[model samples]
Target chain A: MAEPVLSIRDLRKSFGALKATDGVSLDLRPGEIHALIGPNGAGKTTLIHQIAGGITPDSGEVVFLGEDIGALGVAARARRGLGRSFQISSLAPEFSALRNVMLAVQSRQGSSFRFFRPVMKDRSLTEPAMAMLERTGLAARANVPAAELSHGERRQLEIAIALALGPRAFLLDEPMAGMGPEGSRALTAFLDGLRHEAPILLVEHDMDAVFALADRISVLVYGRVIATGTVDEVRGDAEVRRAYLGERP
Target chain B: MSRERAINLLLAGLLLSVPLAALALGELFYITLATRMAILALAAVGLNFALGLGGLVSFGHAAFFGIGGYVAGIFSSHAFNQTPLFSWPFEFFGSDQMPAIWLAAMLISALIALPIGAISLRTAGVYFIMITLAFAQMIYYFAISWPAYGGEDGLSIVVRNGFPGVNTAVPLIFFLVCYVLLLAALALFALVRDSRFGAALQAGRQNETRLAAVGIAPFRIRLAAFTISAAITGLAGALLADLNRFVSPSMLSWQMSGELIVLIILGGTGRLFGPVAGAMLFVLFEFVLGGLTERWQFFLGLILLGVVLFARGGLIGVLAGKARHG
Candidate 1:
């Protein structure tokens, strides 16, 4: 197998008496969708936050691109090619979809300190942004503000923004939370293709998408990974079935 | 082609024409009033960069205004007294030169703003507002207690600061100088508004988390904006001190800071010519209404209330329709 692009090493986080994430470990290899699924309040989001540099773990290491990125900030980690999306759709609501992607493109280009030239006129930012929007099939709504775009469109816009960062690894937290059946199918297909460009650590509740997409599965329970294996192996595991996939499996 | 652009041009043209006309009609006092409008407008323009564009409600901008005023006052007074300001720093003598004082004012104000913004920007919302207000009050009291510059009595220059190739002491020429500088400041604000830096700053204002996800630290962007805003406000302060021939704690007072915010709100927050429009209307109210009754501020209060309740976007918004970005 290929060397893991992202490795989570015994990450632990606590809030006073309760441990949010207790010694969780996982690895995401290149060109693979590693699904992390759990029930409500199982600390899936907390683990994702620690990996994406949003929350500091009490003890652990997040290694990305062969380097320990535990001490880096959200922006620093992102600049170092760790791209992520929030579980909730996070966007600059007032900005157009194209401008939203363009901002990411600008960051990728470096030095936002340029104060004279208008950003809209700069083809370097606009062309790549448009291409990303086109890739996500959001080219028609490029001029609409993110606030005005439909919920699924905003989700696509977020992915376009993440794509413009040219990330080496993707930390996608619930990318299909609000999508309709059709939207989910389209996004599932898109994400299937996206795995080849950058390995995805997907935190999802949608089992259909997860079952169809994940090559490897990690079932999280009470801030701990109870099982990690191929989809069939995890499905047949008695502990995972009892703790999570009960009756449905 | 845009309604806002037309309104901006009209506002700029009116500012220039009125002062020129005042000189023609031998109403030299009106030229002084126009100069006040220009200087105050310049100060508000600076605040708008941080407040309107960056969404930073800085209640302590008067600190920079007073710093600029004090820099001008100290420089000119030392020159008038034939005394060096300091000896250890290569025996630095004071300068009565306008360009030199303006440069010093911008540099000093930016320096002060950098540390203030760096510390204050760590917090957000009400805490940010209160911290800024506290910093301004500290500077205000310091000016009142410090005696070298005449304490509360304030420092007065013997003559207006000198500008090469012109008589700055003449009311019309001085007003023209201020008007030109105001125009330059407006151009700079527009450039920043449309640039790449502005995109990140505005994005930061709207959603800081998203800005970080995009790989830009919102703190550094806001700090740069705050420092630049202070530099422009400081330039206006130097001009104000020169115009009044005085520099007092009044320049650093919290009231001065509040007035700057009020001007931006009254004209149109984030609009290019909002400060100019607000200053013109404010001074006009003082002139026209003050002559009729001593309680003129009561009417200003009524206008402010009306703008807040009915026209939330202020005068320019009413004239230009909704803002392109807002």
Candidate 2:
């Protein structure tokens, strides 16, 4: 009922012959987790890349907060509240988990051109960064570098960094890609609660987590949305069952 | 005390006391040698800001260095001749004032860095390195062909430039001046390294995509760092020209840039005191080896090869352990 926080319309991208993303359109409104479910090479990540301003679409419009943002670069889009998380866990590897989150906090605070004052002593940056780390269950490992963080902790740190941006919507690509069963369950619960703070356009392969958390489901097959509906409606869709669900149905 | 803190204190003490001791013993040549170390250390300190922290391997920093030297040489020459630098718009007479010349050098270097960094930061990897080197070569050739300022023969100052409250013509006084500037620049470097901007710059170096995703433009941060880096280098260049009473195309040569980088790596890249240690070692090698043989650079090359191949962290890393964050 409310205006969508993010709207992607008629997005198309191609690599020579293969149509990576072909006329894909989606919208994420406030207070909902819109799960994008697909098999391998289904163009889920490419579509996320387009929406997050990582890659330019051959033809499309990405509207954020009712403004066309197709021309903005990744940093500009981020400053406008388009938060992104990578499937491969992109982070400052040498920086401590706290410093990594503090970067996000500093970004959210406005111009980071302040040069004389020591950032480590700045409570304004550190306190909120610590809070975010605590929220993601990374408080204990705050001083450890991201390179040394456990796989699950790195994923949690990514979420904490995204949260620090005060994003209007989350473009999370495979947030649970490397997680164990327990980590997945915990993150699923965490993400389900996070949807109340901001809408999430979650691209994931973890069907169990997707089923438990998605307020609405969209099945992407070969770069096209084959079906969009409640879990039961999408689960019963014949094309999705044949193309994606397969024998599991 | 921590080994790093101990080494830091020892370095400060040695740098300060050695020159003062030379002054006490009337070893004027040693004072000059100490002054050379301080000046060269200051130059590498400027390079360290970009190469060490920002991870910008600038191969043309000698362009700024030469610019600073030229600023000092040109201004003092005009002042000595009692000629206005230009007749149009106003009588712009040159100044022998050290502070004014340093300001001019820094401003000019920063201005040059703005355009150079804007174009260079667009690229990364070897392209960035080659482009920067190419820009420095352009300046070097320009200086060579510009006959008004002595061309390839270079410009020389008739006397050392003036600094307030100090007879900069005195060898010991000049060494003290250089020493004080080196310490001030080191303090500034430490402060900048710990700032929020420094955090963003380092993060940009580590993972640019992550930096961009967090809403900080890597290009802007790097451009700022490069500009500041050049300004510091340029100031050191002016002081160096004053020390030698000359400015030449040799200062703009690519070898100077390589030597600056050598000092950084030889000390420890990204470590605060790395340049100081490297400069001391380099000058000492030049002195001792030069005394022993004519082919000293050949031996110096051997030592540099050993450091590169075997001792990855350089003299400071071996002596002081790992850098605090590193």
Model 2 Cα lDDT, one tens digit per residue, B144-164: 999999899999999999998
| DockQ list for all candidates | 0.70, 0.74
Evaluated at residue B217, the lDDT of candidate 2 is 90
Worst 10 residues of 1 chain A by lDDT: A240-249
True contacts kept of 1: 0.80
For candidate 1, give the lDDT: 0.93
* Tens-place lDDT digits, model 2, residues A94-161: 89999999999999999989889999899999999999999999999999999999998999999999
For each candidate, report what fraction of the true interface contacts it reproduces: 0.80, 0.80
Residue B103 CA displacement from its true place in model 1, Å: 0.3
Cα lDDT of model 1 by residue, A118-218, tens digit = 88888999999999999999999999889999999989998999999999999899999989999999999999999999999999989999999999999
Worst 10 residues of 1 chain B by lDDT: B317-326
Q: List ranges where model 1 is wrong by over 4 Å.
A: none
Error of 2 at B270 (Å): 1.2
Indicate the fraction of true inter-chain contacts that candidate 2 also forms.
Answer: 0.80
